[model samples]
Target chain A: MDWISLILIPAIKSLILVIVLLTGFAYATWFERKLIGRFQQRIGPNRAWTFGLGHPIADALKMIFKEEIVPSYVDKILFVMAPGLAIVPALLIFAVVPVGPNITLFGREIPLVVADVNIGLLWVLAVAGVGVYGIILGGWASNNKYSLLGALRTSAQMLSYELPMGVLLIAILLTTALGTADGAGTLSLVQIVNMELPWYIRIWILLAFPLYFITMLAETSRKPFDFPETENELVAGFQTEYGSIKFALFYMTEYLHILGASGVAVSVFFGGWRGPFVEQAPILGVFYFAAKLIAMVFLFIWVSASVPRPRYDQLLRFCWTFLFPVSLVYLAITAAIVILL
Target chain B: MAVSDGIKGAVEIAKSMAVTLRALLAGPLTVQYPEQPIAIYPRFRARHELRRYGNGLERCIGCMLCEAACPTGAIHVEAAENDPEHPVSPGERYAKVWEVNLMRCIFCGDCETACPVEAVVLGHEYELAGYSRDDLLWTKERLLEPTRPNVIIRTE
Candidate 1:
C-alpha cells in the first residue's frame, strides 16, 4: 500500500508530465509560427495538414532521417552528451508543477504533481539555471571560435539575469507572506497557489511581474534577448556545427524550458489552477492552468514577432546597470514592508 | 528621461502594436497562384492570339504590318495567294506561316495596336512554362485559343 502510494503513483505522474510537456513543446512551435505569420500579414506554413497541424510531425520525421554530422574538430564524447545534458533538466523541473488538486483514484488519493516537494520554488529556480551548463559545455566542446563566443555570452547573460529573476521572485514571496497570518511562507508552488490573491487587475504591469517576465524571457534565450543565436553575428552560434538529431534535441530543450518557465510564472504570479468550478471539479483545474499557459505562450510569440533582437553589449549593459539595481532595491523594499507591516 | 517621455514611448509602441493587430484580423492577402489565381486586370497584355472574323475567315491579310512593327523580331509572317477551294482568309493574300517567339516577346501589345484589321491581339493565358526552347516559339495554331464549332460559349 505504501509502495503503491509513494513509488508507483509518482512514477506514473512523472511519465504523464513528460508526455504532456513533449506534446506541448511540439504544438508550441507550430503555434508560434502561426502567430508570427499572422503578425507579419503572411500565411506561414499552410501546406502540411489542416492549418499545418502535421508540421511538427513532419519536422520530427525530417530530423530523424537527416544525416548526423559530428565535426572532427569537436570533442566527441561531450559533443554527443551535451544535448542530453541540456534537455534533461528541462524535463526534470516539471516534477514539482501541479496542474490540479489531489483526487481519489481506486480508493486512494493522489496529488496531481509528480513530486510536491516543500521547496518547489527553489527547486525550479535551481534546476532552471542548470540548463545553462549544457549550453556552456556544448559551446566549449564544439572547438569553434563562434561557439566559444556564444558560450561566453550565454553564461554572462545567465549571470546577469538569473540574479534579478531570483530576487524579484523573492519579492513575490514577500507579497504572499503579507496575505498570511503566521508571517511564514511556504516555497511549495501548490501551497502558494491555494492562498487568496487580490482583486482583478493588470498584475503584469506591476514591477515584480514585469521584472520576472523580462528576466524569464532572457532566461529562455528568446527573441529581443536572442544574442547567442543571432544569425547575422554568430551564424547559429553554439549550434553552428551540430546537425541532425543532436540539433533537434537542443531545439526541443528550448521550447520545453519556455513552457516550464511559463508554468512557474502562472503558478506564482497568477492563481494557477484556481478558478471558478475548479474546486468542485478538479478536472477543470487542469483546464484553467492550461488556458493561462496558452495566454502566456501567446504573449511570448507576440513579443518575439513585435521586437527585434537587441545588440549583445546593449543587452548585457541593460541587465547589469538598470534591471539589476532596480530589482535589488525592489526586493529590499518588499522585505522591509513585509517585516514592518 | 522625463515621465512624459516614458508615457509617449509606451503610447507609440501600443499604437504600432494596434496597427499590426488590425492587419492580423484583416486576414492574409496572398493570391495562391495556379490553385486560386486572382483575376487579371482588363488591359493586361499576355500571350498573343490570331483573331478570326464572324464568318470564320482569318483576318490576317499577310500585309506583314505586325512583322514590321515588332521590335524584338519575334513576329514572323509569310504571304501566299488564297486557295480557291479552301480559302484561309477573305483577302487575296493570306499568311502561309505565322509564328511568335514568346521568349523574346515583351508583351508590349504593339502588334495589336499596329494591326489595321484587329487581326492580332494579346490574350489572357499567362502560364507559359515549357521544358525546351522550341516549345516557347509559338506557331500560328499554338497561339490561338480553340474556337468551338457551334456556340463558342458556355451553356446556361
Candidate 2:
C-alpha cells in the first residue's frame, strides 16, 4: 500500500472517529437525561435549547471553567494520568470496528474502518480489558478508603464478568469456523459481519445473545451492575477526589465506552451496516450503522432507568455461581453440537 | 426450584420495565414555571399587602392590633392622628410608620386575621427572594402599591 493509503488514510479516519465519538458522547448524556426523565414523568432539560439540544455545550462550558482541584494528599502524577489512561482504551476499541463497507472515491477504495486488523475481535476485548486499570489506578492513587474500596470492587467485577464474556465469544468464533463452507473462520470483525450463516448455526447465537447482553451491561459499569460508583455507598466512588476537567475526562470515558461497546455489539451481532439496498447504495450503510447504534444505546438507557442496582455481594455471587456455571454448560453443549454436526 | 425462581425474577424485571415504558409514553406533568405560569390557590397566603377602600382611603386605623398579634414580631406600626384637611385614611387615626420584615414573617397570616378593618391581607405573589435585608423589609409605600415586585403575577 502507498504512504497516503496506509498512513494518511488511517490518520484521517482516526481523526474522524475521535470527533464523532466525542460528539456522540456529549449527546448521549442529553439523550439519557431526557429518556430517563420521561420514565419518571419529569421534563428533563429543556432550558438550554429546544428539548435541551444545546445542554451538552452548556455542560462543556461549565466543566471548562470549574476549579481543577488536585487534593493535597493524592499521588499527583498517577492522579492526573488516570483519567487519560481510562479514556484512551475506550476510544481505541472502535479502531477495528467497521462502520460500513469500502467505498470508491476518486477511483480509490476507502474502507470505513480506521484499522482493519485481522485479530479485530481480540483487539476489541484486549483494549476493553485495559480500561479497568484506569479505575483501579484512580481509586488507589486517591489515598481514600472509599476510593480504594471502589477500585477493588471494579477489579473484582471485571474479572468475574470477563470470564463468561470471553468463553461466549470463543464459542461464537468456533461456530463461525465450523458453520462456514470453507471451514475457515476469520477473527476480523468486518469479515464476521459479512458472513451469512445458515439458520441452524444462527441458533447457537440465540442462546448466547442474552448472556452476551448481560456481560455488555456489566462491562460498561451501567446501572443494575454499577457497583464501583454506587453513590449511596461510595460517595462518587473513584472520582470522589477528582474535580474540573479531569473529572470531565472520567465522565467522557464512560459515555465513550458505552458508544464503543454498542458499536462492537452492532458489528459482531447485528451485521454492522447491513440493511435494505445497502449493497446497491454503500453510503446508506453508514446511516443503517448509526440507526442500529442509536437503538442499542437506547436499550442501555432503558435498562438503566428500569433496573435497580444489585448489592455488591449479590452481583459477584450471581456471576460466579450462576452465570459462570450456566455459560460453562452452554459452552459444553455448543462444543458437543459443533462436533456432532 | 432454583431455575423456576430465576425465570420468575426475569419476568418481574420485564414487568418493571413495562411500567417505566408506560410512564415514558405518558407525557411529563411538569409545569414550566417561568414561561408557563401556574395557578395559585384562592386561599394561598404570600406577600403581605395593605388594602384600601374604593374611595382611595387606606383601611388601616393604626390600632396596633397586628403588631401585637404578630408571633414573630414582624409587623411594626406607629399611630398618628389623621389630618382633617387631608386624611390618609377614613378613620380618625392612621399608620404613620408601617413595616413588615418578611425575613421574620412566617406567612402564617396572623396579622391578616388580627386586622380590624381587613387592611393587611396576604397577596398571591409568592416569589419573595430579595438580595438584602432592607429589600425584604416591605414598607408602607411598598405595601400600599397595587402591584407587587419580585413575583411573577398571573391571573390564573
Candidate 3:
C-alpha cells in the first residue's frame, strides 16, 4: 500500500472506532440509569426527548451552558490538564484492539484494527496506569482536603489492585504457553484467544476470569470500589471544582474508560470476537465483540446496584491480604501445572 | 447464647432474603412515568388551577380566602374593580394578579378547602423540576385554563 493510503486508512478506521465507542458510552449511561432505577423501584429519565433518548443530549446542553468554575485556591494548569490526561489515554488504548479479522474492502485487504502491536496487552496495562495521573492531578489541584484524601486513597487502591491484576495476567500467559508447542508465547489478546485448546485446558483459565473481572472493576474505579468520588462522602470528589466543558471532559473520560475496561475484559477472559457461529461468517466478529461488551457493561451495572461500598480500611485489607495472595498463589499453581502437565 | 444468636441471625437474613426473592419473582415495580404514570389518589395535592363559571367567567371574586388559608403565604392576590365592559366575575371585584410561589407552598390542600367558590383547586400533577428558581413561581397567565384544546398543563 502507498504511504497516503496507509495513513489515511488507519486514521479513518480510528475515527470510526472512536465515534462508535462514544455513542456506546452515551447509551451505556442511559442503560445504567434505567437499570438502576428499576433495581431501586423508581423511574429513570423518561421525559427528555421521546422516551428519554434525548436525555444525554439534554445533559450535554446543560453542561455546555453551565459556568465553568475554577476555585481561587486550585492549581489552574494541572486542574485544566487533568481531564484531558484522563480522556486521551482511554482513546489511545483502543488503537491496538483487534475488533475483527482482515476483510477485503474494494479489492484492498484491510485489517479490522487501528494498530495491532506485538505487546498489545502490556500497552493496554501501561496506558491504563498512566490514566490514573488524571485522577491524581485532579485531586491534588482541587485544593480541598477531601479531594486530596480521595486522591491518596485512589492512588493506594490502584497501586494495590494492580499487583494482583498483573499476576493474573501472568497466569493467562502461562496458560497460553502451555497451549503452544513452543515455550514462547504471545501477549496479544487476539492470538491468545485464537489458541486451539481443549475444554479441560480452557476451564483452568476460566477459573481466573472472576478474579480478573473484580480487579478490572477496581482498576476502573467503578461502583462498590468507586470511593474516590463517592457522592455521599466526597460531595463531588476530585472534579468538584471543575465545571462546563472541562467537567464534561472528565465525565466523557469516565465512560470511555468503562468502555475500554469492558473491551479488555472481554478480549482477555471470554475470548475476543469469537462467537459460537462466528466461524461461518467472519463479519460476525463485530456482533460477538458488541455482545461481550454489552454483557460486561451489564455486569458492571449489576454489581453497582447490588453491592454496597466497602469501608476504606476494609478495601485496603481486601486488596492486600486476600486478592494479592490469592492471585500470587493462582499464578504459582498455573505455572506448576503447566510445567508438570 | 452463641447458638441462639446464630439462629436469630439466620432467621433475620432469611426474612430479608424472602422479601428480596419475592420482589424478584413479582412484576417489575418500575413506573415508566411519562409512558405509564402511577394512579394518583383523589386527594393528591398538586399545582393550583383557576376554575371557571358555566358562562366562561372566573369564580375568584377577589375573596383571597385561599391566600389567607395558605400557611406558607405562597399565594399573592391583587383585587381590581370590575368593569361592566369587561367584567371578569359576578362580584364587584376580580383578582387582577394571582401568583403562587410554589417553592414555599407545601401542597397542604388547605387552599383548595378554604376556597368557598372552588375557584382555585389543585390539579393532578407532581412534576415540578426546572432549570431556575424563577421558573417554579406560577403566574396567573400560566395557572389559567388554556384557550386552546389538547394543551398539556404542567403542575407541581
Candidate 4:
C-alpha cells in the first residue's frame, strides 16, 4: 500500500505531467503565432491542414532532421548540457501545482499533482530560480560574444526582478494567511488556493497584482523584457551557437517556462480549479484549471504583443528604480496592516 | 516622471491595444491567390497578343512600328507581300515573322500604342513562368493563338 501510494501513483502522475507539458509547449507556439498573427491582421500558418493545426508536427519534424552543429573552441559538454539544465527546472516547477482537487481512481483517492509538498511554494521559487543557470551556461559555453552578453543580461535581469516578484508573493501570502480562520500561514500552494479570504484582504492583494504581473513577465524573459534574447542585438542571445534539436530544446524551455509561470500565477491569483459546479463534479475542476491556465497564457501573449521591448539600460532601471521601491512600499504597507488587524 | 505621466502612458498603451483589437476584427488583408480569382485592372499589361478583324483578316500590316517603339527591343517583325489569290490580311502586306522575346519585354504597353492598325495588344495572362528561355520566345503562331485565358476586371 505504501509503495502504491508513495511511489507508483506519483511516478504515473509525473509521467503524465511531462507528456502534457511537452504537448502544451508544442501547441503553445502554434497558439502564439496564430494569436499574434490576428493581432497584426495576418493569417498565420494555414498551409498544413485547416488553420495549420499540423504546424507543430511539421516544425518538430524539421527540428529533428536538422543537422546539429557544434562550433570549434567551444566547451562541448556544458553547451550540450545547457538546454537540459534549462528545461529540467521548468518541468520540475509544475510538480507542486495542484491541477484539480483529489479524485478517486481505481477505488483509490489521488491528489491531482506530482508532489504536494509542505514547502510547495518554496519549491516553485527555488526551481524557477535555477532556470537561469541554463541560459547563463548556454551563453558562456557557446564561446561567442553575443551569447555571453545575453547570459550576463539574463543574470542581471533575474537578480533585479526576482526581489519584487518574491516580495509581492509574500505580500499575497500574508493577506491570504491573515484572512483565514487560523492565523497560521501555510506555504503549500493548494492550501493557499483553498483559503477563504474576506473582501478587504482580496482587494488588498489585488493592489499587488500589477507588480506581480510585471515581475512575472520579466522573470519569464518574455517580450518587452526579453533583452537577453533580443533578436536585434543578441541574434538569439544564448541560442546563437545552438542549432537543430539543441536549439529546439532551448525553444521548448522558453515556452514550457511560460506555461509553468502561468500555472503558478493561476494558482496564486485566480483561485486554482475553483469554479461554479466544480465542487459538485471534481472532474470539472480540471477543466476550470486548464481554462484559467490558458487565460493566463493568453494575457501574457497579449501583453507581449502590445508592448515593445525596452532598451537594456531602461529595462534594468525600470526594475531597480521603479519596481523595486514600489514592491518594498507594498510589502511594508501589508506588514503594518497585518500587525494592526 | 510624474505619476500623471505614468497614467498617461498606460492610457496610450490601452489605446494602441484597442487599435490592434479593431484591426484583428477587420480580418486579414491576405489575397489567397490560385484558389481565388484576383481582381486586376483591365489596362494591366502582361503578355503580348496578335489581333484579327471581324472578317478574320489579320489586322497587322507588317508596319514594324511596334519593333521601333519597343524600348527593350523585345519585338521582331518581318514583312512579306500577300498572295494575290488569298490575302493573309486586308492590306497588301502581312507579318511574315513576328516574335516577342518575353525575357526582354517590359510590359510597357508602348507596342500596343505604336501599332497603326491595333494589331498588338497586352493581355491579362501574366503567370509567364517557363522551363526555358525558348518557351517564352512567343512566336507568330503562339501569339496569334494564346492558350491561356485572360482575366481583366473593368473598373469602369
Candidate 5:
C-alpha cells in the first residue's frame, strides 16, 4: 500500500471518531441532566428544542457570545492554552476505541478504529495521564493561591489513584494471559476482549470491576472524588481566570473525559461491543457499544447525585490504604491461580 | 446445612421481590404532566402574568422594579408616558417594552415580589414548555392578562 493511502485511512477514521465523540459528549450532558432531574423529582431542560436536544447548542452559543475576561496577573499564554490541552487528550483517546467490526466501505475493508496499534491500552493510559497537566498548568499559571492549592490537591489525588489503576490492569492482564492458548500474552484491547473463559474466571474478573470503575471515576475528577474543583473551597478551581469560549472548552473536556473513561471501562470489563445475542452481527456491535457506554454514563450521573464528596484525607486514605492494597492482592491472586491451574 | 442454605436463599430472594411487588401494586408514579394535570403548590412560581385591577385597569405603573430584582437579568421593561388618548392604565406611565428572557431566568420569584403594585405574579400554569429560544422569550402581549369570555376569581 502507498503511504498516502495509509495516511488517508487513519485521517478519515479519526475525523469520524471526532465527530461521534463530540456529539456523544454533548448528549452525555443532556443524559446526565434528564436522569438526575428524575432522580431529584424535577423536569430538566425539556423546553430547549425537541426534548431539550438543542440545549447544548444553546449553551455553546451563549458561551461564545458572552464577554471574555482576562485577568491582569495571569500568564496569558498558558491561560489560553490550558483548555485546549485538557480537551485534546480527551478527544485523542477515542481514536483507539473500536466501535465495530471490520466493514467493507467503498470496496475497501476498513477497521472500526482510527488507530489499532499493538500497545493500544498503554496509549490510552498515557493519554489520560497527560490530561492532568492541563489542570496543574492552568492552576499554577493563574497566580492565584487557591488555584495553586487546588492544583496541588488534584495532582496528588491523580497520582495516588493512578497506581491502583495500573495495578488493577495487571489483574486484567493475568486473566487475559490465562485465557489465551499459549502462555504468552497480547495486550491489544480487541484481542483481550475476544478471549472467552468459564464462569469461574469470569466471575473473578467481575469482582475487580468495582475497583477499576471507582479509580476511573477518581481519574476523571468527578463528584465524590471531585476535590480539585470543589466550589466550596476553590472558586472554579484552575479555570477561575478563564471566561467565554475558554471556559466552555474546559467544560466540554470534562464531559469528553467522562465518556472516554466509560468507553475504556466497557471495553475492558463488560466486553467491548459484545452482547449476549448480537455478537454475530457486525452492525449490532455498534448498538451494544452504545448501550454499554450509556449505562456507564448513567451510573456516573446517578452516583454524582446520590453520593457526597469525600474529604481530602478520606480520598487519599481510600486510594492508598484501601484500593492500592486490594489491587495488589488481586494481582497476586490472579497470578497464583494462573500458574497453579 | 442444605435446608439452612435453601431457607437463606429464599429469604433473600423474597426480600428483593417484596420491593418489586410493592412498586407494582402502588400504581404508576408518573403523573403524565401534559395529559393528566397535577395540582400546583399555592406559592408555586410558574410563568409570569400581568395582574388586572377590579375595574380592568392594569396594575403595573411601569416602575421596572421586577427587572431590577431579577438576578439573571431575565426581565426587560421600558416605561412610556401614558396619554389620555391611548391610555394603557390609570397610572402616569405604562410599560411599552416588556419582555422576559425565560432561558436566563432562574424563576426565583424575586421578580414577582418586587412588583410594588402586585402587578406581576407567577401563575399556577407551570407548563412553560417551548421549542426554541425565541419561543421562551415571553413578550408583553403573551404575558398580559388572560382575554377570555368567562371571568374567574383571582386567588392570592
Candidate 6:
C-alpha cells in the first residue's frame, strides 16, 4: 500500500473520529441532564428548542459568547494551557478504539480503527494518565484555596483508584491469555473484543468486571467517587477560577474522559463492536459499540443521581481497604489459575 | 460501622438500584411543561395581586398585619389618613406606601392569611424574573389590577 492508503485514509478516519467524538461530547451533556433530571423527580433542561435537544448547542454558544475572565493573580500560562492539555490526551486515547470492523469503502479495504496499535490497552492507560495532569495544572494555576484542594483531591483519588484498576486489567489479560488454546494472549484491544467470549464475562473473571467498573467510575471523577469538583466543598474544584470557554473546555474534557473510560471498559470487558450479526453486517458494529457506550453512560449517570457523595475519608478508605484488596487477591488467584491450567 | 453494616450497605445499594430501575421503567414523572400546562392547586399562593371592593375602592385598610406576618421582613407599609374627598381604601387609614420586596418574600401565604379585608391575595402568576433586584420589588401600582381594561364594571 502507498502512503495514500496508509496515511491519508487513517488521517480521514481520525478526522471523522474527532468530529463524531466532539459532537457526541456535546449531546452527552444534554442526555445526562435529561436522564438525571428524571431521577431526581424533576424535569431537566427542556427549554433549549425541540425537546431540549439544542441545549448542548445553546450551552456551547453561551460559553463562547461569555467573557473569558482570567483573574489578576494566577499562573497565566498554565491556566490558559490546562484545558488543551486535558483535551489532547482524552482525544488521543480514542485512536485505538475501533467503532466498527474492517470494511471495503470505494473499492479500498480499510480497518475501522484510527491507529490499531498493538499495545492499544497500554496506550489508553498512558493517554488517560496524561488527562489528570490537566486537572492538577488547572487547579494549581487557579491559585484559589478550593481549586488547589480539588486538584489535590483529584490527584489522590485518581492515583488511588488506578492501582486497583491496573490489577483488574492484569486479571483480565491473564484470562484472555488462558481462554484460547492456539496463541498467547494479545494486548491489542480489537483482538480482545474479537475473542468470542471475553474473559470478563466468564464466571472466574466476573468478580474483576464490577471492581474494574468501580475503579473506572472513580477514575472518571463521577458522583460516587467524586471529590475533585464536588459542588458543596470545592466550589467547582480545579476550574474554580476558569470561566467562559475555558470552563466549558474543562467540562468538555471531563465528559470526553468519561466516554473514553466507558469505551475502554466496553472494549476490555464487555464485547466491543462484537455482537450477533456484526461480521455479516459490519456497520452494525458501530451500533453495538454505541449502544454499549450509551448503557455504560446511563449506568454512570444513574449511579451519580442515586448515590450521595461519601465523606472524603470514607471514599479513600473504601478504595484502599476494600477495592484494592479484593482486586489484588482476585488478580493473584486468576494469575495462579491461568499459570497452572 | 460493623461487619453487618457493610452487608447492610450492600443491601441498601441493591435496594437503591431496584428503585431507580423501577423509576426508569415507569417513565419520567416530569410534565412536558408549556406544551402540557402545569395544573396547580386553586389555593396555591404565588404572586400577590391586590383586590378591589364592589364599589371600585381599594380593599386595603392600611392595617400592618401582613407586614408583621411576613417571615422575611419583605413587606413595608406606611399608612396615612385617607382623604375624605377621594377615599381609596374603605377605612380612615389607608396604605399610602405599600411595597413588597419579593427577593426577601418566601411565598409562605402568611400575608394572605393575615390580611383582614383580603385586599392582598396570592394569585397564580409566578413568572417573576429580572436582571436586577429592584425589578423584583412589587409596588402597589404593579399589584393593583387596572379595572380589567376595556371590560365594563357593572356597579352593584
- Which candidate tops TM-score? 4
Ranking by DockQ: 4, 2, 1, 6, 3, 5
Tens digit of per-residue lDDT, candidate 3, span A149-268:
878878998898999999999888877876566867788766776776667768888888877877888888888798788888888788777889888887887878888988887877
Clashing pairs in 6: none
Correct interface contacts retained, every candidate: 0.44, 0.76, 0.16, 0.58, 0.00, 0.33
Q: Write the per-residue lDDT of candidate 6 for residues B1-156, one digit (tens) a residue.
A: 354655678788878877876776676777775566566665666778889899989999899999999999999998999999999888999988889999988999899999999999887776678789889998999889643222222333
lDDT of 5 by residue, A256-339 (tens): 989999888888888888886664567788888899999899878766766678789988987887789878989999989878
lDDT, candidate 6, at B33: 56
Q: How do the predictions measure up, each by TM-score?
A: 0.93, 0.91, 0.74, 0.96, 0.72, 0.78
Candidate 1: tens digits of C-alpha lDDT, residues A1-341 = 68888688888888889999888889999998898888888888788999999999999999999999999989999999999999999998878888888777798787788888999999998898899988988999999999888888888998889988988888878777655567587788988877764542125216477668889889989987886677888898788889999999999988998899899988888778888987688888889999999999987877787666878887887777777787888888777766776
**Which model, 3 or 5, shows the larger DockQ?**
3
List the candidate 4 regions with Cα displacement exceeding 4 Å: B146-156
Model 6 alpha-carbon drift over 4 Å, by segment: A179-182, A197-201, B1-7, B28-156
lDDT winner, 1 or 5: 1
On lDDT, the stronger of 1 and 4 is: 4
CA deviation > 4 Å runs, candidate 1: A179-181, A198-206, B1-16, B147-156
| Local error of candidate 4 at residue B10 (angstroms) | 2.4
What clash pairs does model 2 have?
none
Native-to-model Cα distance after best TM-score fit, residue A82 in candidate 3, in Å: 0.9
Top DockQ model? 4
Q: DockQ of every model listed? A: 0.45, 0.55, 0.13, 0.62, 0.05, 0.26
Interface RMSD of 2: 1.8
* Worst 10-residue lDDT window, candidate 1 chain A: A197-206
TM-score of chain B of 3: 0.76
| Model 3 Cα shift for residue A16 (angstroms) | 1.1
Q: A116-179, model 2: which lDDT tens digit per residue? A: 8999999989998999999989999999999999889999998999988888887888777774
Alpha-carbon error at A218 in model 3, in Å? Answer: 1.0
